[model samples]
Target chain A: MKTLTPIEQLPLFTTQIKAFINWTRKNALWPLPFGTACCGIEYMAVVGSHYDISRLGAEVVRFSPRQADLLIVAGTITEKMAPVLRQIYEQMPEPKWVISMGVCASSGGFYRAYHTVQGIQSIVPVDAYVPGCPPTPEAVFQAVIKLQEKISKGDTPSQRLVAKKKMAELTSGNLENTGS
Target chain B: MEYHFQLVHQIKESLGDKAITSVETGIGNPFECVLVVRREDVRKIAEYLKGQRNFQYLMDICGVHYPNREQTLEAVYHFYNRDQKQRVRLKVPHKEGESVPSLTPVYKAANWFEREAFDMMGLKFEGHPDLTRILCHHQFVGHALRKDYPATQNQVCDAPEVFSFPPLPLNEDEDVLTNQRTLVNIGPSHPATHGTFRIYAELQGERIMRAKAEIGYLHRCFEKMAETHKYQQVIPYTDRLNYLSAPMNNAGYCRAVEKLIGIEIPARAQYIRVILNELSRIIDHLVCIGTTSVDMGALTTFWFCFRQRENVYELFEALCGNRMLTTITRVGGVYGDIDDEWKRRCTGVIKTLRETIDEVDRLLTNNKIWLNRMKGTGYVSQANAIDYGFTGPCLRAAGVDHDLRKAEPYYDYDRLEFDVPVFTDSDNFARYMVRMEEMRQSCRLVEQAIAKIPDGPIQVNDPKIVLPPKAEVYTNIEALMNHFMLVINGIQPPKGEIYSYTEAANGELGFYIVSDGTGYPYRVKVRPPCFPIYSSFEETITGGQIADAVATLGQFNVVAGELDR
Candidate 1:
């Protein structure tokens, strides 16, 4: 790690400062809800008139998956739904975050049996896990707050590097596992 | 008494001198008597019940597998009379792949019910016009509900051939009139489906000639999963099925298990159950009415209804600590008791909701545009509605006087006073009005239950069945041990089967639990109301306009979670 000398870094970091400002302004995300089950309902309630998550910049609830920057995996991922869920997560643009919003999404909750995907993390790498059978809108709001914190870290090195590396990794992993 | 005696004697006289195979009086009123009839006489006897005896409504067609019995499979038909208001059960046996004569010719409702029977249990219907899978995919093999079928994923299926429509013969990419109806898959991805559902519609110039619902995209095999989980553990799964009306499914499953074990809950617990159930009904109806209006192009009505629904969710969150798929009620009773603050807030919310409902009614009920969009659209004649075995608001909309609350009156419903609103026309408009009226009735029911709640214990006093209090379990060794065992292994019920039906927001949500003296249910069958209602979609929308399909199905409030379960 290199130390920052005030005078030496000031002129050099000026361009970086301008870029950070632009990134922060653009990345003030407005989530599009694609909620399906119990968690999806709570996700709506969180953004609805009561627990207004719009206060934290997610005012626009777009129904389509393409526009969302944060994909909240908020319900049970059954075998029939797994493919669609993966497709939706893949459709979302890069620099996205996933909030596993319930026990089901975190680790299949009460349905950690044969049909359910063991955890949503297996499909999309989750940034935060909201641990409850169906976490309250307040807890969901808190998870969003945590996502904002992760966002404020500026350049997510792990996310950028891993996202690039994982395509090949996933293809090979799928070959070994599901043999797709 | 007269109807029951007449029906019993009629069964004995009509079916020769065959001994009654089973007589069960414990399953509520109109005590069920099952008589095994030869497969050849099923349609003849069903026709007699329809033409002469006036058992007009084929309530349901279900198949029960008896592996050890002399006969292999028993296809049971539950019939109910419109005038006499009595039920009769008919049981007929079938060998593998053999046909039982279809009752569709007698009762049109049996068309889809028999299709479902064929899908899950592989009981063939010989005389049916179209015998296809209703819940599972078209290509899915293996009878899921068979006793011999393995419950887990390990029972591997030889993947069926995936057939795609032959690519349109290209003429240099020029569009041509092929004289073939264009097939459009309207969902399984579309927003209006509510869940993973696809409607394979054969469109002949925007008129759907054949609109087949291809479900099972969210098929979790809930019944098979129930067998592995303990009886108490299965309640959460019920919450997932009809997630919009979670409490109803939770209570329905719990009631079945309680009936099998003969566990009587305390009055306060029953009152709480009633309150939660009514609240769920109001919320579920709000979604239905809101979506119906939204489909009819009244987007503002959905906003109003959804705003009020938010408050309901808040009240639910306050009481149960979770909102959707609440898992509020446990096996023997509710998970915990509601305090005075939650009760007071709920009372105030219900009062405010009544005012909001009046505003909403003013906006959508009499509005000419809303009326035009709904008024004669998707009309199901009185006969067709009953013949399709529609229930809840959809049936009530068609002037049917059947409400499980009035007919069976479970959970002290008889003690409450409420009117079952019935509309004469079974159109989309009438269904919307019926649900709106029913929401008001649910509000009334909730207020009554809240005011009359007693000062007794909430849970039933059975340590073997109901786990001890959480605080007690944390402190006391004996309580902790009971909790550990109960949570780990599940509560065991006596070796018996019980069917308990609840008037869910959609329709009759019944749970049939077969317990073999074990902690987990041997086989838990769910009678999801949406399956039958959605099955009637193609029949209802045959000659109607394209937009009527959405309005009609929206009024049905067919949640795919429950429909495909």
Candidate 2:
């Protein structure tokens, strides 16, 4: 077989680029089912039928860190699972957004014990926090929509401000409580 | 019944000087006979019961450690007369170093119970076939359940001594010797083995020859944790046990506390409890049946069942505001009443569930491939099932008509109209059918509960047990103070011990709480259905094919949290 020139590809157009971007965004939102514990059960519920996350075109929950884009940290991330969680985050492709889907994932909720990681943001960057000891499936859907909003706005993924914000809240106790 | 009591008395007379005090009744019915027989008499007594007295079903075997007593380890055996419907308690006290003879040769259920006693309290069972540590790892040194055993700093250093099964002739190649028994550890990853669990399987080719379940990965010392936390504070921890069936765990805990407090729950509360309990049961059996299908390569059925479960979880979320771990029930009653919106949502979900269940049945029930994969794979003989003390759908699948919902009706289960589904096969297919039928019955129970739900205060009228409404807490100072006290320092029941059980999705989820007239429970012991069922996995799947083990394990529906706890 003779070698072919690399420049024989079709010319890129604005419509094609937009379509490609839209299609890639829709098709490849490989959700990292970063389920740490119990709330992970509800996280499954979100992707499951009642909420039907597939409607947003992001139902393929990847267990591996390398193949994922959206990380749904749906349970209590203890100290033990934290390092592994960070490793998984580091393995994910760039422009990854983390959805902390429960109170346990958000701020350690009921289990703010010494062993618990307090919040998942302590390890990975979080874009949204669905608050509850275990957030309801509806709340999980809303969080997913919120993440999609940020993506559609062309906004960069939020850094670890939530962790700092939580630390500050704990230290100062001056922040107004959000509608959890 | 009198003759049965006389027979038990005759047996006690046979023991003569060995038999200690036999307390009759206060604990209800069957006539409680406490035997202070020597540890060596355990097997003899077990044999005698089976041979002479006909105490066929070994209902439960519990190990109690009295650190201050003359004899430290007390193994209590509760046997039920299958034909007579009578229960008897047989107690044998042993010292720390002594080894009791195993009754596993007689009633195979004693196999796991004996191993558990050995693993937890370090009480040895002489002549127990393959009695290495069952729950804790091989390296686990100290028995955690012993009164003197330190809760913290317990470690298993070395691998347990391998149980020598009947050895097959060498396969010529030396490499076969090295690779014959492949050990695979699954879970503690949150999803693998239903709740936090680790299974160490000894596989002879993909087939699990003798797999030992290493539980307590997510122990959290919940028993000790409950001991420190107040009665109300412990509800949240119960939610973690069987995350799939939190309501059952909650009900078990609350029922135990209610018994100790000696207060009757309101009729409305009972109805609410029945509804929620049945709802949880529906969700649980859905997960069990669905996950078993998933384990056996039936993804579509799993999806269908999961769809139904999604609606169920939404109902739970609507009622409790939490999906996975709904710490909805309070000490005396529920945290709050289901509002009009919640009731409407529940009704809507229930309707959907009925249709979804039918959809799931259509997808799974008659599917030839599904049936082929499960049919004769993990068959438990009727004799073995009863011998193993298998409860829930596992025993029901083996043709046992015993269901705690009917046998020992709790939370107005008697009032609820539903049929217990049973099958004779006792295989994975039978278990699948049982759970599917159970979900349908649960739906019927929920419908009945919803229709007859009385208009009254949801919580019990007794102010000591349940907290006032949150709205009242915000307005009234007394209510606010009551809320503060209830939240911080939970309710304290009088000094007493009570055993309470509920028909959890998997089986009978029971809790025995001992209160020392303190805010916290004196001791909390969970009689989770999964622990015994999971422990019997090795025996169940021993001769079956490799896929059968996974299907069997899935069919068992062993929640690791409940198992380890």
Candidate 3:
């Protein structure tokens, strides 16, 4: 084995390594398609030949949470489906992001009723909100680009740490709010 | 109209006069006649209609809440006779505690409709075999469709307990049961089940012994919201019912409200509606065939189908502002007039779509694997299909030549020349063939409608129902006043109850609205076609392989939005 030089272990090398990691992660994000209603159809259109989300490196749709790094929640989430969404979010591997893809998924849109959840953010943190009753395929592509930009600028290691910290804060906050 | 009156007279004569309380004709509309029967005599009356009177088709069963009446809850059943080409509405009003006899024994299609009635309005069926909540979670509290229930109340709940299937006991006397059978649960999120539907299947070896389908993951309480919204506002809500065929829903709801108000739209608008409806049917069949092929492991056909679907969406975007949720129809007519450019572009897209569908047909129709997966997979007999109240392509595929457009034409559908495709195989492949042929017929209809469209006003001349153009409203005081009144007060139909049905892409999509001479509807019941089609799913997939379940479900084209709503 060759001996490591002192200059090879400098801070510059670590910064280059982190940049490379961020670049690759931003370019290739495997998405879990959590589609429930109308927006789901638009999501499929985005992945189809015309809008072609593959241009942005998001064509690989993973149905399982364990293999995906991005969660595209594409439609209305009812109260009965909230816990299941949270469980899937929990099941995802670390360093994941969620894109709330339509008006109903963002703020319940026109369906402010008994069964629908107000917005998915009540249960999980959202990184980007694509807003339309059912957002067009172009709008979905724009959201994917926005998420990619966030991934590019994000401090990869610090992002994981911040997500963990936020999860803890949300848990404690929910516990306190429920107690009163 | 005379036939309906005579049918009511016969119903009164067949059952004693004491069985029926009163007969109300022309209460709101001239065409619809209401027969009020006692709660206990509903079964006897339904049996008489089916057995003696030949009203074999039970179209829909729904509940209405009349808060001020002595009998607060009413169960309404819509029946049709294919041979006679007649329809009747049977109303049975009961108090809160009274239970209506289950009609499932008479028409097997009543199984899920009764469950939905119970789920929505708390109307109990006396002898329903599996009368659990069909469209709401088991933990849901008050009935949603009752007048007293608030529309905006949010019921926060925890994760539902994991549903456990009851243990299946093996027969010790049978020598075939040497191995243990396993129970498998497929999705409320599985990709193959399409959209948030769960099915539990008991499997012994590779064959499924029994299967039960559980729905309601996408129930957004549309009917509850409709009661609170104005009539015009409910049009957009219908778009989400079957997202693939949105314009058909818009036209269906608009026609129902138009029927209540008794106004006829212009010739140009009716032709435009026919064009849009046939276009929607084409796209719906495209999605169904494409998705079924994808589920059976043919990926290329999905791409080909979506390519055409994208073109159709582009055409819709040119007409309306949005693509999929095109709220394009108004109460009395369509939102805007179709220009020459739109007509040219739509024709071009339809031509391209025909070629694309042909390519898809060449790819999948003769493939050996596709045939093996779908040929005899989910066999539904003609008798069972009619008993289960299958409609649209599913019924036609079972050799029943019943098409609403042909039997009781609406919106100038009689003017168009088209063929209703029917097949006798009554299997998964038969459904595929029927949908494919229907797409060709729809394309022909669209071409004819575009060619024969007359030049005239798009909306009726009723300022009370339709808003005047902004140019007229800005310049003329009368137009401005009319626009102001319409925008503020909304469309108000007379007090009446009417059930309007259209041949939707999936089946016969019916809307039964009871009005109280108010801006808001008293009760709006959407009879989604998928409700009954999905009810027979368990029976269809019982003896088939587990893989065939996915293929069968995809061909059924059960959209969760309509099914749960």
| Two-chain DockQ for each candidate model | 0.24, 0.14, 0.64
Native interface contacts kept by each candidate, as a fraction: 0.26, 0.18, 0.72
Q: Write the per-residue lDDT of candidate 3 for residues B1-565, one digit (tens) a residue.
A: 6766676677678777677777766433455567888999899889988998788888899998888999999999988777876676899999989999999999999998999899989999999998988777778898988888888887776875465567758777766655667789888877897798989888888788878888888999999889889999999999999998999999999989998998888998999889999999999998888888888989889888888998988888888888898999998889868889999998899899889878988998898999999999888899888888899999998999989999888877898899999999989999999999999999999999999999998899888999989999989999999998887878999988788889999989999988988889888888888888988999999988999989999999999888887
Docking class of 3: medium
Q: What class would a CAPRI assessor give candidate 2's docking?
A: incorrect
User: How far out, in Å, is residue A101 in model 2?
Assistant: 6.1
Name the weakest run of 10 consecutive residues (lDDT summed) in model 1 chain B.
B154-163
lDDT of 2 by residue, B103-149 (tens): 88888778777776777667777898867665555555666666565
RMSD per model, one decimal:
6.2, 8.4, 4.2
Best by TM-score: 3
TM-score of chain B of 3: 0.97
Taking the tens digit of each residue's C-alpha lDDT, what string does model 1 give over B1-565? 5555665577668776563444455354445544567788777778777888887877778787778877778787777675665666677877766788888778877887888788888888888987876655444567777777766532222222132343546565543564456777665555566556667666667677766666666666787778777888788789988888888888888888887788777888899999999998998888888767766777777778778988887787777766676888876788878889888998999998898789889998889988888889888888887777788999999998899889877889999989999999888889989988988998999999988988888788878888888899989999999888888778988886666778888888877666788787877878888877887887787766666677777877888778777
Candidate 1 local accuracy as lDDT? 0.75
* Model 1 regions more than 4 Å off: A1-32, A64-73, A86-101, A120-130, A142-180, B1-5, B19-30, B66-72, B93-98, B128-141, B146-150, B154-181, B296-299, B470-490
Query: Which 10-residue span in candidate 3 chain B carries the lowest summed lDDT?
Result: B24-33
